[model samples]
Target: MNKVHYLNSHVEKFREDIKITIDVENIGDLTHYCNLHIENKKVTKIFTECFHKKETYKDLIKKLPDTVERLGLFYLTTVYWIAYTCHYHNDKFDEAMGHCLDSIDMDVPLLNSPHFCKKVYYYLNPIDEVKC
Candidate 1:
């Protein structure tokens, strides 16, 4: 499997809410197959609305030092997920993506996107289309 599992808490409310996971092997371009697409307009709209949280990123940035310290064996890999989440709706696409590409090259998964909601139902979220 490309990825043994993927957390789906950000999507539909499954019974085992915390157990929401999708399995796809990490070979070839598995982005679409992995269901990372924010397909549902409702979900996408919700995400678009909530994605603009300077407060949240600021909080995370403040805690980054502590958060990093709390990481263990998978620290490097784990941090990118956060970075990805940040860039998913982040305003600073260029900078965030630079970090994301580096993360992916290092074998870290970046789930964030620069794409718009409508296109998210189709492909990668476009950085230039974020509804500021």
Candidate 2:
């Protein structure tokens, strides 16, 4: 993100904010002291709105990249959230499966075993038999 804009917006009173945040100058000196504000609060808030099958939820998820999907322990959480959103929430089965298998690739375990995603939910969901 553009740090100069952040420095101008958040820490308006401090030059240190400008130097460390924008220029990355004397970086080691402010390693622990400088806290750069990226203004990501809005993005974080949007993702925190849980899962979505369509409408606003789908629109919001489209804004994020798949790299973000691989972060945190959200792989399983996101998969199930998608399932619930499609099956019970929005009745958008095809879209949910698309997200579960493709976008999130919730199936890929960054761990030793990649089958982790299927074994947990996709593999056992009786609903998969329910005709798309």
Q: Which candidate gets the maximum lDDT versus the true structure? A: 2
lDDT against the true structure, per candidate, is 0.31, 0.38
- lDDT digits (tens) for residues 1-132 of candidate 2: 598977755754442421112122221221121122222444444444433323343455465545443322223333434434544545466555555456435532222232453343433333445576
Could you tell me which residue pairs clash in candidate 2? none
Candidate 1 structure quality by residue, lDDT tens digits, 25-88:
2211212212333223332232233334422423333333332222221222222233344445
TM-score of each: 0.22, 0.24
Please give the lDDT score at residue 132 for candidate 2: 62
Off by over 4 Å in 1: 1-39, 52-92, 106-132
How far in Å is the alpha carbon of 40 misplaced in model 1?
A: 2.2
Q: Please list the residue runs of candidate 2 whose C-alpha ends up more than 4 Å from where it truly belongs after superposition.
A: 1-43, 49-58, 65-80, 83-132
